[model samples]
Target: MADDLLLGIDVGTTNIKALVFTTGGALAASASVATPTERPHPGWAEHDPHTLWQAVVAVIRRALASIDDLRRVRGLAVASVGEAGVLVGAGGEPLTPIIAWYDQRSAPYAQRWKTHDDPLETFRATGMLAAPIFGIFKLQWLRDYEPEGYAAATTWLHVADYIAFRLCGARTTDYSLASRSMLFDLRARRWSESLIDRAGLRGDLLPELVVSGTRIGAVTPEAAAETGLAPGTVVGAGGHDHVCGALAANVRRAGDCLDSMGTAEAVFLPLDDIPLDERLFIANVSSWTHVTFGAHVARDRYYVMDGLFSSGAAVEWMRRLAAPGASFDEAAAEVETLAASAPPGSMGVLFLPHLAAGERGAFVGLTTSSGRAALARAVYEGLAFEWRHMLDTIEGMLGVRARTIRAIGGGTRLPVWLGIKAHVLGRPIQVLDMDESVALGAALLGGIAAGVYHSEDEAVNALQIRERTVAPDVALHALYERIYREAFLRLAPTLAPVHTALNDLEMI
Candidate 1:
């Protein structure tokens, strides 16, 4: 039924949003609630699991009220930021708060990263970089720092799965979410017993794994009453936010890639094989299973991802600093226009946007001539240069040139920034018009589970989305390649010691 709606819930780090889409892929209604993250101590980020779940329920109720006929809504699915999962007790109540991925509380484990197993072998099994950003280390943090909570915990559920469990009483996670835990075996399509033992975790406490698009169950009467959803309305497991967003962006083949320009700008590539390239480590990239059990996009392909943790956040920072009186839309327009007026390379001034984690943003070669526009342009170019660096690493591994890069999120709205990214990558950048791609993706997966769509590909096609492709300017590309090779690429290494000093002094 065209009128039948699919509900997609996106539990992001900053906000929890619920969106409803028609079977024909039209967005019917939407509502959002801000998600307040707590930072009690330095380098710690936490969220109260029950508080977040209550916000999820509130958003759904608000979104359901957006339309007059709520009965038209059918299945529902949830997507959440990866790595931040909920630790629930034996009775399915939360035992500990969800740890934010950016939280550096687990950084101490990196010193003994290979304590239990070979690092390379662990990567081969989990396809996750040995970093504190993953869930496994967070679990270790709990066991070591909060022993009592660890002792009481029964199941560790990814943020999406925890919400799904509350909705339908199913403790299940999909392949995409499971892979981020650094416990799931990417190739074997199950939890890695050896890795689990090495991490001193029991497989029994892990949520049961399921393929994405599988109808796990339906919203329970308790969930329905709280959120105004119909009891027994179908629901399904969902994937990582970027993976689900890729589905809406039509990233389904080996050459397909997505540049999610959000709070953090992430680069995604579909791979046909488990990438064994050690250079990926050097480049800080990691591979993982697609939402489907096997390779993503196609049956034989997988996916790899890398990111800059400060993308849109940098823009927001600049907006507050350079254009405080301007509204967001006004500031964005000003930046776009300024980027056009200020030449490439930000007029010989380079900006490095390592703005998070107690690190300061740098603008070297700043002279009296530097202005707000120049700094803004430098920010755009700096992020674009980083994007090129990640893509270069992927290209080096694949030994093939990319044709186009698909981009999503609010960053796509800035034509100048998209143009800068296109020129830096030397490829066309295509941005889809799907306003709620992530939530729509979750809902589309719900549609598939409800038998509204036959498959993932069909679910994507049902949107019938056509995108605008930003073509690279040949001269601009050449100029960016030269500037990137000469200056921007060298800034990070040279500043590492400076960052270390700042951290040591508590001066950041």
Candidate 2:
């Protein structure tokens, strides 16, 4: 059984990756392909379901090619971005494209829903903040704009659920993924019939919900032939990518937190039960089910989550503007060299990373001597400041401080940024050895379904997770505490009216 392998497929915003790992947590092989996002109209984004399926197949086959004996692969599962999903027809074809989770095209629908319903009631039932990023709003958009497709659809499946359905012909969704739909009841752990009826959606449009790691079915012959997977290999359920990453990082307790910094960054903290307090709704924090059950240490747990829309995206934008034509490594090196030479706090420069609609990023207090390095450092500091502010809000609302914060994803590669974050937060950060935590978490679930591990703890113990702590600099932390309290904390409130005025002009 030492040779037994598990496969985890991650359907991310930028790429789709298939990672094969041994039961003991050593990676065996991996392959990745760009995730194609089509923008047919401004402010709208989508993924062609067929094209996505093809990419998944390609990555699976490409990764498995390195293995000597395919029989050693015992099980597979999928994890993906939440909220974005495709509606499927009765004949098992996608009725509509998978709408990108960040698409703003559904904003009008979300606004209409907010006008008709009490947002507090909705938040109480769904544990969501009633945003356009939720699946229910996307469904409403499709219902009105693409009536034929909406009428013909039999079920709606999240990205990971759709991939699993394609592999094994099962129509099911896990609780963690379903929690993002804005149609699920958080306390009842089921789709809300009242909300569905109020939204005028079909009663049966959603799939049956199950806990993560459940073995839905085996890989079908057709899928096996296409992807080089063994026929009848167990296919287990997976959940939202961030939740899976938390699982891999062992962030399963009340005080443990996972800082998943990728294209978008999420701060996830598990809770023992759902909090229906109005403070969470006001703070824009979401309460949702964890992707855990059945012998897991965090079984039947809930989590409070929130995030910045553009964390790594802001860094990538800076790379394009400041280090054009430079490789990412080259740009990163430049940033490191310049930042180290420059003073802390980027020499009085401050950046506000609001690169979304209605607001633009700004670099205030820049002097004639400020250069690209200073600008890059300011960006990192700005992000850290924002995260500290967010954490403060979360802790204030929940009355629970994050005892241990584990950092994961692409941003952890930047040592300077990690140090800045540690100083800004005035807390030590634990950086994990594993980069592919999301995929690894899904693979662990697959291992569970295959009987390779008896429980989540066993799977995690096998990995023997290694981490290094990034402790804060006391002197830098003291300085950052003052700057954050005085200037950075006031930026958003002072700029809100200006942003609103600009948005008004754009509308006109």
Candidate 3:
């Protein structure tokens, strides 16, 4: 199996990674290095695309150093946090800093586009809701804010597409990444020229959309020399990190789902068709192409994503602010001990976990008696409850049931949170064996593109490995049911006024 080696690269919000995988479905060697992002102003996040490209080369070189038989590595793929932007010049140099998906400077700009006449028609055409994080608005914001830069822009590319351009000297994005941009018509499976025009951007700026796992090209000799990899190694189009992570968890069918608790908690599941429900707007049902076989067939197989947008992020904030010296484990441990001491409902003190900007769950009586411990427990409970609400909301829209949910990411490392999620959702949760499944999934796709696997299913079968399963506790389930009912009935409705007042205050 040393004869068949594949490399997968993941460029994420905070780090860049390269994983070397053996053809026999094992991680042979890996390397990771931090990618820098600058916060120039409040609510703005920017990364120098050149820095990321260099990090990618660095990790690949380090991984190659660890592998004795470098000649065996035949293919590579790059998975990244998908956001649309421009890569310019003769070699696709970025004209400006890459705007992150988390940047909210374009929020109000996106809001205006959302309220444009014929919003539903436009939405149906694009298969995505207009949002600041979706990249279409970012492009509009770019045109509006930096008209000079827009004119100078030569080629617009998604992060993965930009990385591919660096390695193979070509431009393209997989359907999954394209679908995230709100520029691609998910149903039509192409760039929506109408939407592009509406956003005041040129349609030609977008890269060609390919299905994941298709070889875009071989790594250029220059790229190989810089990265210490053999020239002409195949490079495949990879999907978004979240979708790749789901594939890493072995989520193939409709019922196979993953609850990834990163900074935010997202529930991803495969669906047989495009969910055409008005409630998708209310429930915030976002869809992406399957990592493989994403073509629409009278129906399309999609990955439906529902998330709180803020979960572990909230916990991280609390730990940083309140317990400056405490590690996450220590903070969580403190929360558990204190929560056990406190009453079931945090002593009538309700916390709305809208710590950042968005609110997903509810609240009740607010008293000063709610100490830090109660607030901590509330943050944890609120996140769990929000996931519960999202699960129900997604099911209502799909008109189908998810038999079980698998937990992945750093969150799964916490048995307590995993237990809380399972009890709150009333379902068994399985934890994937692999860490960095996103990179692994990307590697598997590259392997297929290089002809290491006969089919996508075979690739998945060879790659996925289950770690353990956590079943719901009946006693905890009953208690959580009572709490969820009270939280939904009295907590959610009561928080509307508080939320309004909080918005008025602008405390953050």
Candidate 4:
């Protein structure tokens, strides 16, 4: 009875999720398991690739075990958090632990790139700013610090690509994932060989290129035995989790954007043109290959992305500190209650939530008058301010102002937080009904590759996009504008000395 089901395995930083859906576009079953991130040393965040692979297999098997019949699965693909990857040795095994984007071990490497002349050229080629969060910088870190591991590696692969290779013996990566590496040529739709050589990286380390939804291969017999997939179950190419999540949220066409709120908050707009807009590049927002390329796209279409990296993480941290041992739902309720009573300015406290490893968050303008509720409200407002800042920066780059933003993921569940974002950004937030849009997007891609849908457009049209609009309170807009300009905007620069000291002491 379950024979026509499609599967989506989302490998996220906090957890791994698997969703099974019928061809009729109804959810059948879903399961998830924690995927722990390990911090073995200062400024390093990583996960053993072998253990990650085992977790993936176990999660997939557990999800499939609940189905009435294992043969019901038609196809599946992996969606993963961007910018984390590992290298494979000659025998096609992991040579090193996967370095997470949150890891700052490569911070110095990114700093060194600042001395390059005409930085716009690198941005034009890769569509990425020179940051440690990019995969190239992480690669440089590994090569410089762990030369043995680098030498042992025969191929370097992003998270989704490695899972794809495991399931189907295909060593290929999609453009959407490749674009996050700062090594892919946006115009060429391939790896930048010149940049690779310049970085002293082996040209052969990269995977073969593939379009996002193409059928890489069927589940191998070995994979089938390990997991519960049928031997012939299709495996399709997938990309970054946010891009895939956007696909399900219908973030296409001009002026369309998706606000995906997970541990991080991602805001990206589907762009039809890939002009190396020096202005946009200089603004520092990233332009990347979209997950689903249109039929007419010839290496020239992309999505412009900007985000609040610690948006959800900030709130979560505050919740734990404010009320230890409380569930997220319980903490969220408390924050909402307090935020509703508190004014828009968070009572003069400006919390900077972008503290790096070993660095604790700072609350500026704190006085003896400050209480826990004010601290909680400050965290909420800080996240909203960052979101507003991202919108301003990305809007300037894209030259299109969004009147409506489609929101998805866990953050959408909190109405109070959504209201704060809506008020701060001064736009109507269309919060989607589904919390698992990332999983749904992955299944959509798998369905396309399996011939269940004629094309990406058809698959998107079939998605059940139930949502409610959260409109901004006109009065709060003026109040937030003042706070954003005077308090939130001034705090970062004012604390530059603290950040500098933290870095110098090697404590952050």
Using lDDT, give the best candidate's number.
2
Which scores higher on TM-score, 3 or 4? 4
- The estimated TM-scores of all candidates read 0.94, 0.95, 0.89, 0.93
The order by descending lDDT is 2, 1, 4, 3
Candidate 3 residue lDDT tens string, 1-508: 4478889898886678999987666888989997678889877888888887888888989888978877789888888876645546544668877888778788887778767745566656655566678778788888788787777776778888888888998788888887778777777788888888777787767777788888899988998889998888899888788777777677767877778777656777787667544555444423211111122110135767765556777767656655678886787676566555665556665555654423434445657787876766666667787777767666766677888777777667666567666777778877877777788888888887888877777777776475787888788788888878865435655666866787568745
Write one digit per residue (lDDT tens) for candidate 2, span 1-508.
7889999999998889999998877889999999989999877889999999999999999999999988889998899998899999999999899999888898888888878888888878877666788889899899988899999999999999999999999999888898888888878888899899888888688999887888889999999999999999999998899888888898888899889988888778888887776766665533221111111113587887777778888888887877789998998777767666778888889999878532466888989988877888899999999888777767777788999999999889889889999999999999998888899999988888788888888887888668999999999999999999999988877777887788778778
Worst 10 residues of 2 by lDDT: 288-297
Considering only N, C-alpha and C atoms within 3 Å, which residue pairs clash in candidate 4?
A: 2-72, 3-72
Scored against the true structure, residue 452 in model 4 reaches a CA lDDT of: 78
Q: List model 4 lDDT by residue over 1-508, tens digit each.
A: 2258889889997899989877655788888888867989867889888788888888888888878877678778788988899999888888888998788888788778867534677877876667778888889888988799899888889998899889998888888888888888877787889888777788788899888778899999998898878898889988889888888787866678778998888777777876576765655534221111111111234787776677787877877886688887887887777777776677788887775433445788888878887887888788788777767767766578975689999988878788988888877899889888888888878888888777777888776667799999889988888889877777766777877787678743
**Scored by CA lDDT, what does every candidate get?**
0.80, 0.85, 0.72, 0.79
Report RMSD for candidate 3. 3.8
Give lDDT: candidate 3, residue 131: 64
Q: Deviation in angstroms for 54 in model 1?
A: 1.5
> What is the C-alpha local distance difference test score of candidate 4?
0.79
Alpha carbon lDDT of residue 353, candidate 1?
A: 83
Q: Give the clashing residue pairs of candidate 1, or none.
A: 271-302, 295-301
The runs of at least 3 residues in candidate 1 whose Cα sits more than 4 Å from the true structure, single-residue gaps closed, are 114-117, 277-301, 357-360
Give Cα distance to truth, residue 356, candidate 2, Å.
3.9
